[model samples]
Target: MRHRKAGNKLGRNHSHRRALLRNLVTSVVIEDRVETTVAKAKAVRPLVEKMITLGKRGDIHSRRQAAAFLQTPESVSRLFATVAPRYGDRQGGYLRIVRTGFRQGDGGEKAMIELLGAEQELGAKQQKRAEAKAKKREELERQLAEQGGNEEGGSEENA
Candidate 1:
Protein backbone atom coordinates (compact mmCIF):
# COMPACT_ATOMS: atom_id res chain seq x y z
CA MET A 1 0.00 0.00 0.00
CA ARG A 2 0.92 3.68 -0.15
CA HIS A 3 2.90 4.85 2.86
CA ARG A 4 5.09 7.80 3.93
CA LYS A 5 3.60 9.92 1.16
CA ALA A 6 2.71 13.17 2.91
CA GLY A 7 1.22 15.10 -0.01
CA ASN A 8 -0.85 14.64 -3.15
CA LYS A 9 0.93 14.88 -6.50
CA LEU A 10 -2.08 16.49 -8.18
CA GLY A 11 -0.89 15.33 -11.60
CA ARG A 12 1.71 18.06 -11.83
CA ASN A 13 5.45 18.29 -11.64
CA HIS A 14 7.18 20.23 -8.87
CA SER A 15 7.25 23.67 -10.47
CA HIS A 16 3.71 23.52 -11.87
CA ARG A 17 2.27 22.22 -8.60
CA ARG A 18 4.00 24.92 -6.59
CA ALA A 19 2.73 27.60 -8.95
CA LEU A 20 -0.82 26.26 -8.83
CA LEU A 21 -0.82 26.18 -5.04
CA ARG A 22 0.48 29.74 -4.85
CA ASN A 23 -2.22 31.01 -7.22
CA LEU A 24 -4.94 29.17 -5.34
CA VAL A 25 -3.68 30.52 -2.02
CA THR A 26 -3.60 34.04 -3.40
CA SER A 27 -7.15 33.72 -4.76
CA VAL A 28 -8.46 32.43 -1.45
CA VAL A 29 -6.77 35.23 0.44
CA ILE A 30 -8.05 38.03 -1.78
CA GLU A 31 -11.59 36.79 -2.45
CA ASP A 32 -11.90 34.77 0.78
CA ARG A 33 -13.37 31.95 -1.31
CA VAL A 34 -12.27 29.54 -4.02
CA GLU A 35 -14.05 26.72 -5.85
CA THR A 36 -11.76 23.87 -6.77
CA THR A 37 -11.35 20.14 -6.63
CA VAL A 38 -11.32 18.51 -3.19
CA ALA A 39 -7.73 17.38 -3.66
CA LYS A 40 -6.65 20.90 -4.58
CA ALA A 41 -8.59 22.45 -1.71
CA LYS A 42 -7.07 20.05 0.80
CA ALA A 43 -3.61 20.69 -0.58
CA VAL A 44 -4.06 24.46 -0.45
CA ARG A 45 -5.32 24.44 3.16
CA PRO A 46 -2.00 24.01 4.96
CA LEU A 47 -0.17 26.53 2.82
CA VAL A 48 -2.91 29.10 3.40
CA GLU A 49 -2.85 28.47 7.14
CA LYS A 50 0.88 28.96 7.12
CA MET A 51 0.40 32.27 5.35
CA ILE A 52 -2.17 33.31 7.92
CA THR A 53 0.24 32.35 10.67
CA LEU A 54 2.82 34.52 8.99
CA GLY A 55 0.24 37.28 8.86
CA LYS A 56 -0.33 36.85 12.56
CA ARG A 57 3.36 37.38 13.07
CA GLY A 58 3.08 40.74 11.24
CA ASP A 59 6.83 41.15 11.08
CA ILE A 60 9.01 42.23 8.19
CA HIS A 61 10.48 38.78 7.79
CA SER A 62 7.03 37.22 7.85
CA ARG A 63 5.80 39.71 5.29
CA ARG A 64 8.69 38.92 3.01
CA GLN A 65 8.10 35.21 3.37
CA ALA A 66 4.42 35.60 2.58
CA ALA A 67 5.11 37.84 -0.38
CA ALA A 68 7.53 35.29 -1.69
CA PHE A 69 4.98 32.49 -1.57
CA LEU A 70 1.81 34.33 -2.55
CA GLN A 71 1.04 35.30 -6.16
CA THR A 72 0.38 39.03 -5.99
CA PRO A 73 1.54 42.02 -3.92
CA GLU A 74 -2.07 42.94 -3.16
CA SER A 75 -2.81 39.47 -1.82
CA VAL A 76 0.20 39.66 0.45
CA SER A 77 -0.98 42.95 1.90
CA ARG A 78 -4.55 41.73 2.36
CA LEU A 79 -3.42 38.60 4.14
CA PHE A 80 -1.61 40.71 6.71
CA ALA A 81 -4.17 43.49 6.94
CA THR A 82 -7.62 41.87 6.94
CA VAL A 83 -7.44 38.06 6.90
CA ALA A 84 -4.98 37.70 9.75
CA PRO A 85 -6.83 40.09 12.06
CA ARG A 86 -10.10 38.18 11.58
CA TYR A 87 -8.51 35.22 13.34
CA GLY A 88 -6.62 37.18 15.96
CA ASP A 89 -7.98 35.41 19.04
CA ARG A 90 -8.33 32.04 17.32
CA GLN A 91 -5.71 29.33 17.07
CA GLY A 92 -5.88 27.17 13.94
CA GLY A 93 -8.43 25.97 11.35
CA TYR A 94 -8.77 29.14 9.38
CA LEU A 95 -10.46 27.54 6.39
CA ARG A 96 -13.62 25.53 5.73
CA ILE A 97 -14.10 23.18 2.78
CA VAL A 98 -17.66 22.57 1.64
CA ARG A 99 -18.33 19.92 -1.00
CA THR A 100 -20.17 21.44 -3.95
CA GLY A 101 -20.74 18.15 -5.76
CA PHE A 102 -18.89 16.75 -8.78
CA ARG A 103 -17.69 18.18 -12.03
CA GLN A 104 -19.89 17.01 -14.88
CA GLY A 105 -17.21 16.26 -17.45
CA ASP A 106 -14.67 14.29 -15.42
CA GLY A 107 -16.88 13.53 -12.43
CA GLY A 108 -14.21 14.81 -10.09
CA GLU A 109 -15.44 15.97 -6.73
CA LYS A 110 -15.63 19.76 -6.43
CA ALA A 111 -15.52 21.81 -3.25
CA MET A 112 -15.65 25.40 -2.15
CA ILE A 113 -12.89 26.51 0.20
CA GLU A 114 -13.70 29.66 2.12
CA LEU A 115 -12.53 31.53 5.16
CA LEU A 116 -14.51 30.77 8.35
CA GLY A 117 -16.26 34.11 8.97
CA ALA A 118 -17.00 35.11 5.35
CA GLU A 119 -20.61 34.05 5.85
CA GLN A 120 -21.27 37.16 7.89
CA GLU A 121 -20.38 39.33 4.91
CA LEU A 122 -22.35 37.07 2.61
CA GLY A 123 -25.35 37.27 4.95
CA ALA A 124 -25.26 41.03 5.03
CA LYS A 125 -25.19 41.12 1.23
CA GLN A 126 -28.18 38.80 1.06
CA GLN A 127 -30.09 40.90 3.55
CA LYS A 128 -29.43 44.05 1.56
CA ARG A 129 -30.52 42.35 -1.67
CA ALA A 130 -33.72 41.10 -0.04
CA GLU A 131 -34.54 44.56 1.24
CA ALA A 132 -34.04 46.10 -2.20
CA LYS A 133 -36.16 43.39 -3.83
CA ALA A 134 -38.97 43.95 -1.35
CA LYS A 135 -38.88 47.70 -1.91
CA LYS A 136 -39.06 47.21 -5.68
CA ARG A 137 -41.93 44.75 -5.35
CA GLU A 138 -43.86 47.21 -3.16
CA GLU A 139 -43.39 49.94 -5.72
CA LEU A 140 -44.68 47.68 -8.51
CA GLU A 141 -47.76 46.72 -6.50
CA ARG A 142 -48.56 50.33 -5.70
CA GLN A 143 -48.32 51.26 -9.37
CA LEU A 144 -50.66 48.41 -10.29
CA ALA A 145 -53.16 49.49 -7.63
CA GLU A 146 -53.11 53.04 -8.86
CA GLN A 147 -53.63 51.89 -12.46
CA GLY A 148 -56.67 49.77 -11.41
CA GLY A 149 -58.20 52.68 -9.49
CA ASN A 150 -57.79 55.00 -12.45
CA GLU A 151 -59.32 52.51 -14.85
CA GLU A 152 -62.39 51.99 -12.61
CA GLY A 153 -62.88 55.74 -12.17
CA GLY A 154 -62.72 56.30 -15.90
CA SER A 155 -65.18 53.46 -16.61
CA GLU A 156 -67.66 54.81 -14.06
CA GLU A 157 -67.50 58.30 -15.54
CA ASN A 158 -68.19 56.87 -19.02
CA ALA A 159 -71.19 54.85 -17.69
Candidate 2:
Protein backbone atom coordinates (compact mmCIF):
# COMPACT_ATOMS: atom_id res chain seq x y z
CA MET A 1 0.00 0.00 0.00
CA ARG A 2 2.85 2.42 0.83
CA HIS A 3 4.16 2.76 -2.68
CA ARG A 4 5.67 5.90 -4.36
CA LYS A 5 5.35 7.69 -1.03
CA ALA A 6 9.03 8.33 -0.52
CA GLY A 7 9.98 10.39 2.56
CA ASN A 8 9.48 9.80 6.24
CA LYS A 9 6.41 11.30 7.85
CA LEU A 10 8.17 11.53 11.24
CA GLY A 11 4.68 11.35 12.76
CA ARG A 12 4.04 14.91 11.70
CA ASN A 13 1.53 16.23 9.22
CA HIS A 14 2.56 17.77 5.91
CA SER A 15 2.76 21.45 7.02
CA HIS A 16 4.57 20.65 10.24
CA ARG A 17 7.02 18.41 8.45
CA ARG A 18 7.69 21.15 5.89
CA ALA A 19 8.26 23.69 8.65
CA LEU A 20 10.57 21.39 10.56
CA LEU A 21 12.63 20.73 7.46
CA ARG A 22 12.77 24.45 6.72
CA ASN A 23 14.03 25.24 10.20
CA LEU A 24 16.58 22.45 10.08
CA VAL A 25 17.82 23.63 6.70
CA THR A 26 18.09 27.19 8.00
CA SER A 27 20.03 26.10 11.07
CA VAL A 28 22.42 24.00 8.98
CA VAL A 29 22.92 26.91 6.61
CA ILE A 30 23.73 29.30 9.42
CA GLU A 31 25.78 27.06 11.72
CA ASP A 32 27.31 24.83 9.05
CA ARG A 33 26.54 21.92 11.41
CA VAL A 34 23.56 20.64 13.34
CA GLU A 35 22.90 17.60 15.55
CA THR A 36 19.53 16.05 14.96
CA THR A 37 17.67 12.77 14.88
CA VAL A 38 18.82 10.37 12.17
CA ALA A 39 15.56 10.41 10.27
CA LYS A 40 15.38 14.16 10.39
CA ALA A 41 19.00 14.45 9.33
CA LYS A 42 18.43 12.14 6.42
CA ALA A 43 15.32 14.04 5.43
CA VAL A 44 17.12 17.37 5.61
CA ARG A 45 20.20 16.28 3.68
CA PRO A 46 18.69 16.50 0.21
CA LEU A 47 16.94 19.73 1.04
CA VAL A 48 20.21 21.32 2.15
CA GLU A 49 21.98 20.05 -0.94
CA LYS A 50 19.23 21.61 -3.02
CA MET A 51 19.65 24.90 -1.25
CA ILE A 52 23.37 24.81 -1.89
CA THR A 53 22.65 24.05 -5.48
CA LEU A 54 20.50 27.13 -5.59
CA GLY A 55 23.31 29.04 -3.96
CA LYS A 56 25.64 27.86 -6.65
CA ARG A 57 23.23 29.24 -9.16
CA GLY A 58 23.87 32.68 -7.56
CA ASP A 59 21.17 34.49 -9.43
CA ILE A 60 18.31 36.73 -8.37
CA HIS A 61 15.74 34.01 -8.96
CA SER A 62 17.81 31.51 -6.99
CA ARG A 63 18.21 33.98 -4.15
CA ARG A 64 14.49 34.61 -4.05
CA GLN A 65 13.77 30.92 -4.13
CA ALA A 66 16.20 30.27 -1.28
CA ALA A 67 14.78 33.16 0.72
CA ALA A 68 11.28 31.79 0.30
CA PHE A 69 12.25 28.36 1.58
CA LEU A 70 14.69 29.32 4.35
CA GLN A 71 13.71 30.99 7.61
CA THR A 72 15.85 34.12 7.63
CA PRO A 73 17.50 36.61 5.32
CA GLU A 74 20.82 35.98 7.03
CA SER A 75 20.75 32.30 6.12
CA VAL A 76 20.03 33.13 2.51
CA SER A 77 22.92 35.58 2.39
CA ARG A 78 25.26 33.12 4.11
CA LEU A 79 24.23 30.41 1.69
CA PHE A 80 24.89 32.68 -1.25
CA ALA A 81 28.06 34.19 0.17
CA THR A 82 29.86 31.65 2.34
CA VAL A 83 28.36 28.17 1.93
CA ALA A 84 27.79 28.26 -1.80
CA PRO A 85 31.27 29.54 -2.61
CA ARG A 86 32.89 26.75 -0.65
CA TYR A 87 31.19 24.19 -2.85
CA GLY A 88 31.68 25.97 -6.15
CA ASP A 89 34.15 23.53 -7.67
CA ARG A 90 32.32 20.46 -6.33
CA GLN A 91 29.27 19.02 -8.09
CA GLY A 92 27.05 17.47 -5.45
CA GLY A 93 27.13 15.97 -1.94
CA TYR A 94 27.32 19.29 -0.16
CA LEU A 95 26.45 17.90 3.26
CA ARG A 96 27.44 14.89 5.32
CA ILE A 97 25.63 13.10 8.12
CA VAL A 98 27.55 11.30 10.87
CA ARG A 99 25.91 9.07 13.45
CA THR A 100 26.76 10.30 16.92
CA GLY A 101 24.78 8.15 19.35
CA PHE A 102 21.30 7.63 20.76
CA ARG A 103 19.41 10.10 22.84
CA GLN A 104 19.08 9.14 26.51
CA GLY A 105 15.33 9.63 26.50
CA ASP A 106 13.19 7.63 24.07
CA GLY A 107 16.36 6.02 22.65
CA GLY A 108 16.20 7.89 19.38
CA GLU A 109 19.32 7.79 17.23
CA LYS A 110 21.20 11.09 16.86
CA ALA A 111 23.38 12.27 14.02
CA MET A 112 25.38 15.33 13.13
CA ILE A 113 24.70 16.95 9.77
CA GLU A 114 27.32 19.30 8.51
CA LEU A 115 28.49 20.99 5.36
CA LEU A 116 31.32 19.05 3.75
CA GLY A 117 33.97 21.77 3.45
CA ALA A 118 33.40 23.39 6.83
CA GLU A 119 35.55 21.22 9.07
CA GLN A 120 38.35 23.75 9.45
CA GLU A 121 36.01 26.64 10.06
CA LEU A 122 33.95 24.70 12.57
CA GLY A 123 37.10 23.54 14.37
CA ALA A 124 38.46 27.06 14.61
CA LYS A 125 35.14 28.38 15.85
CA GLN A 126 34.93 25.70 18.54
CA GLN A 127 38.50 26.38 19.63
CA LYS A 128 37.80 30.09 19.85
CA ARG A 129 34.72 29.40 21.96
CA ALA A 130 36.70 27.17 24.32
CA GLU A 131 39.42 29.79 24.72
CA ALA A 132 36.84 32.46 25.45
CA LYS A 133 35.18 30.29 28.06
CA ALA A 134 38.54 29.56 29.71
CA LYS A 135 39.43 33.23 29.72
CA LYS A 136 36.12 34.12 31.38
CA ARG A 137 36.59 31.42 34.01
CA GLU A 138 40.08 32.67 34.80
CA GLU A 139 38.82 36.20 35.14
CA LEU A 140 36.06 35.11 37.50
CA GLU A 141 38.52 33.13 39.61
CA ARG A 142 40.90 36.08 39.77
CA GLN A 143 38.06 38.31 40.89
CA LEU A 144 37.01 35.84 43.57
CA ALA A 145 40.61 35.57 44.85
CA GLU A 146 40.92 39.35 44.99
CA GLN A 147 37.63 39.60 46.88
CA GLY A 148 38.77 36.96 49.36
CA GLY A 149 42.07 38.73 49.90
CA ASN A 150 40.29 42.04 50.44
CA GLU A 151 37.95 40.43 53.00
CA GLU A 152 40.92 38.87 54.86
CA GLY A 153 42.73 42.22 54.92
CA GLY A 154 39.64 43.93 56.36
CA SER A 155 39.19 41.23 59.00
CA GLU A 156 42.86 41.59 60.08
CA GLU A 157 42.52 45.35 60.27
CA ASN A 158 39.42 44.99 62.49
CA ALA A 159 41.21 42.47 64.71
Candidate 3:
Protein backbone atom coordinates (compact mmCIF):
# COMPACT_ATOMS: atom_id res chain seq x y z
CA MET A 1 0.00 0.00 0.00
CA ARG A 2 2.62 2.48 -1.12
CA HIS A 3 0.01 5.20 -1.52
CA ARG A 4 0.84 8.91 -1.64
CA LYS A 5 4.50 8.11 -1.14
CA ALA A 6 6.48 10.72 -3.04
CA GLY A 7 10.15 10.75 -4.03
CA ASN A 8 12.41 7.80 -4.63
CA LYS A 9 14.29 6.35 -1.69
CA LEU A 10 17.33 5.61 -3.81
CA GLY A 11 17.98 2.64 -1.52
CA ARG A 12 19.16 4.94 1.27
CA ASN A 13 17.76 6.05 4.58
CA HIS A 14 16.44 9.56 5.04
CA SER A 15 19.63 11.15 6.29
CA HIS A 16 21.84 9.54 3.65
CA ARG A 17 19.39 10.39 0.89
CA ARG A 18 19.22 13.99 1.98
CA ALA A 19 22.98 14.25 2.11
CA LEU A 20 23.36 12.71 -1.32
CA LEU A 21 20.85 15.05 -2.87
CA ARG A 22 22.44 18.07 -1.19
CA ASN A 23 25.89 17.18 -2.50
CA LEU A 24 24.54 16.52 -5.98
CA VAL A 25 22.71 19.81 -6.06
CA THR A 26 25.74 21.67 -4.83
CA SER A 27 27.96 20.10 -7.46
CA VAL A 28 25.47 20.98 -10.20
CA VAL A 29 25.32 24.55 -8.98
CA ILE A 30 29.06 25.04 -8.92
CA GLU A 31 30.05 23.07 -12.03
CA ASP A 32 27.01 23.99 -14.16
CA ARG A 33 26.74 20.31 -15.09
CA VAL A 34 27.17 16.95 -13.50
CA GLU A 35 27.21 13.37 -14.84
CA THR A 36 25.48 10.96 -12.51
CA THR A 37 23.08 8.09 -12.52
CA VAL A 38 19.78 8.80 -14.24
CA ALA A 39 17.75 8.12 -11.14
CA LYS A 40 19.94 10.43 -9.06
CA ALA A 41 19.81 13.16 -11.69
CA LYS A 42 16.06 12.89 -11.75
CA ALA A 43 15.81 12.91 -7.99
CA VAL A 44 18.07 15.92 -7.64
CA ARG A 45 16.37 17.84 -10.46
CA PRO A 46 13.56 19.36 -8.42
CA LEU A 47 15.90 20.27 -5.59
CA VAL A 48 18.24 22.05 -7.98
CA GLU A 49 15.28 23.85 -9.50
CA LYS A 50 14.19 24.94 -6.05
CA MET A 51 17.66 26.28 -5.31
CA ILE A 52 17.67 28.21 -8.55
CA THR A 53 14.25 29.57 -7.74
CA LEU A 54 15.62 30.82 -4.47
CA GLY A 55 18.56 32.29 -6.26
CA LYS A 56 16.15 34.07 -8.58
CA ARG A 57 14.52 35.58 -5.56
CA GLY A 58 17.80 37.33 -4.81
CA ASP A 59 16.86 38.30 -1.29
CA ILE A 60 18.46 37.87 2.10
CA HIS A 61 15.98 35.22 3.26
CA SER A 62 16.34 33.23 0.09
CA ARG A 63 20.10 33.47 0.28
CA ARG A 64 20.05 32.15 3.85
CA GLN A 65 17.77 29.31 2.84
CA ALA A 66 20.04 28.39 -0.04
CA ALA A 67 23.10 28.56 2.16
CA ALA A 68 21.49 26.27 4.70
CA PHE A 69 20.74 23.61 2.10
CA LEU A 70 23.82 23.77 -0.11
CA GLN A 71 27.13 22.35 1.13
CA THR A 72 29.55 25.18 0.35
CA PRO A 73 29.34 28.95 0.66
CA GLU A 74 30.93 29.28 -2.77
CA SER A 75 28.05 27.41 -4.41
CA VAL A 76 25.48 29.56 -2.69
CA SER A 77 27.34 32.70 -3.72
CA ARG A 78 27.73 31.51 -7.31
CA LEU A 79 24.09 30.53 -7.46
CA PHE A 80 22.99 33.98 -6.50
CA ALA A 81 25.68 35.88 -8.31
CA THR A 82 26.04 34.05 -11.62
CA VAL A 83 23.54 31.25 -12.09
CA ALA A 84 20.53 33.16 -10.94
CA PRO A 85 21.35 36.27 -12.90
CA ARG A 86 21.79 34.17 -16.02
CA TYR A 87 18.25 32.85 -15.66
CA GLY A 88 16.61 36.17 -15.04
CA ASP A 89 13.56 36.88 -17.23
CA ARG A 90 13.17 33.18 -17.89
CA GLN A 91 10.16 31.42 -16.42
CA GLY A 92 11.44 28.05 -15.25
CA GLY A 93 12.98 24.80 -16.44
CA TYR A 94 16.44 25.93 -15.61
CA LEU A 95 18.04 22.56 -16.16
CA ARG A 96 18.08 19.75 -18.72
CA ILE A 97 18.99 16.08 -18.42
CA VAL A 98 20.53 14.14 -21.26
CA ARG A 99 21.04 10.40 -21.10
CA THR A 100 24.71 9.73 -21.71
CA GLY A 101 25.24 5.98 -21.39
CA PHE A 102 25.63 3.17 -18.91
CA ARG A 103 28.31 3.14 -16.28
CA GLN A 104 31.05 0.61 -16.76
CA GLY A 105 31.07 -0.93 -13.33
CA ASP A 106 27.43 -1.66 -12.47
CA GLY A 107 25.83 -0.85 -15.80
CA GLY A 108 23.77 1.84 -14.18
CA GLU A 109 22.20 4.26 -16.59
CA LYS A 110 24.07 7.57 -16.62
CA ALA A 111 22.97 11.05 -17.58
CA MET A 112 24.32 14.58 -17.74
CA ILE A 113 22.31 17.18 -15.90
CA GLU A 114 23.19 20.67 -16.97
CA LEU A 115 21.94 24.17 -16.44
CA LEU A 116 20.16 25.62 -19.43
CA GLY A 117 21.86 28.44 -21.39
CA ALA A 118 25.26 27.42 -20.02
CA GLU A 119 26.62 26.18 -23.34
CA GLN A 120 28.88 29.17 -23.76
CA GLU A 121 30.43 28.82 -20.34
CA LEU A 122 30.82 25.09 -20.70
CA GLY A 123 32.33 25.52 -24.14
CA ALA A 124 34.86 28.02 -22.90
CA LYS A 125 35.82 25.76 -20.02
CA GLN A 126 36.31 22.86 -22.39
CA GLN A 127 38.41 24.97 -24.70
CA LYS A 128 40.66 26.02 -21.85
CA ARG A 129 41.08 22.42 -20.73
CA ALA A 130 41.91 21.31 -24.26
CA GLU A 131 44.47 24.05 -24.71
CA ALA A 132 46.16 23.17 -21.43
CA LYS A 133 46.34 19.52 -22.39
CA ALA A 134 47.83 20.37 -25.77
CA LYS A 135 50.39 22.60 -24.17
CA LYS A 136 51.44 19.87 -21.76
CA ARG A 137 51.68 17.36 -24.60
CA GLU A 138 53.88 19.69 -26.60
CA GLU A 139 56.15 20.25 -23.65
CA LEU A 140 56.51 16.52 -23.10
CA GLU A 141 57.31 15.92 -26.77
CA ARG A 142 59.95 18.61 -26.75
CA GLN A 143 61.58 17.09 -23.69
CA LEU A 144 61.59 13.66 -25.35
CA ALA A 145 63.18 15.08 -28.52
CA GLU A 146 65.88 16.83 -26.53
CA GLN A 147 66.65 13.68 -24.62
CA GLY A 148 66.82 11.63 -27.82
CA GLY A 149 69.17 14.10 -29.44
CA ASN A 150 71.43 14.14 -26.42
CA GLU A 151 71.52 10.34 -26.32
CA GLU A 152 72.53 10.11 -29.99
CA GLY A 153 75.23 12.75 -29.60
CA GLY A 154 76.65 11.03 -26.57
CA SER A 155 76.78 7.68 -28.40
CA GLU A 156 78.60 9.29 -31.38
CA GLU A 157 81.18 10.86 -29.06
CA ASN A 158 81.71 7.54 -27.32
CA ALA A 159 82.30 5.82 -30.70
TM-score, structure 2 vs. true: 0.96
**Residue 111, candidate 1: C-alpha displacement in angstroms:** 0.5
Whole-model lDDT, candidate 3?
Answer: 0.97
Q: Compose the digit string of candidate 1's lDDT tens values, residues 67-152.
A: 99998999998999889999999899999999999999999999999999988876887799999999999999999999999999
lDDT of each: 0.95, 0.96, 0.97
Q: How well does candidate 3 score on lDDT at residue 156?
A: 100
Model 1 TM-score is: 0.76
The estimated TM-scores of all candidates read 0.76, 0.96, 0.93
Pick the winner on TM-score between candidates 1 and 3. 3
- Arrange candidates, best lDDT first: 3, 2, 1
Q: List residue ranges in candidate 1 displaced over 4 A.
A: 1-5, 123-159
lDDT of 3 by residue, 25-46 (tens): 9999999999999999999999
Error of 3 at 158 (Å): 2.2
* lDDT for 40 (candidate 2): 99
**Which pairs of residues collide in candidate 3?**
none
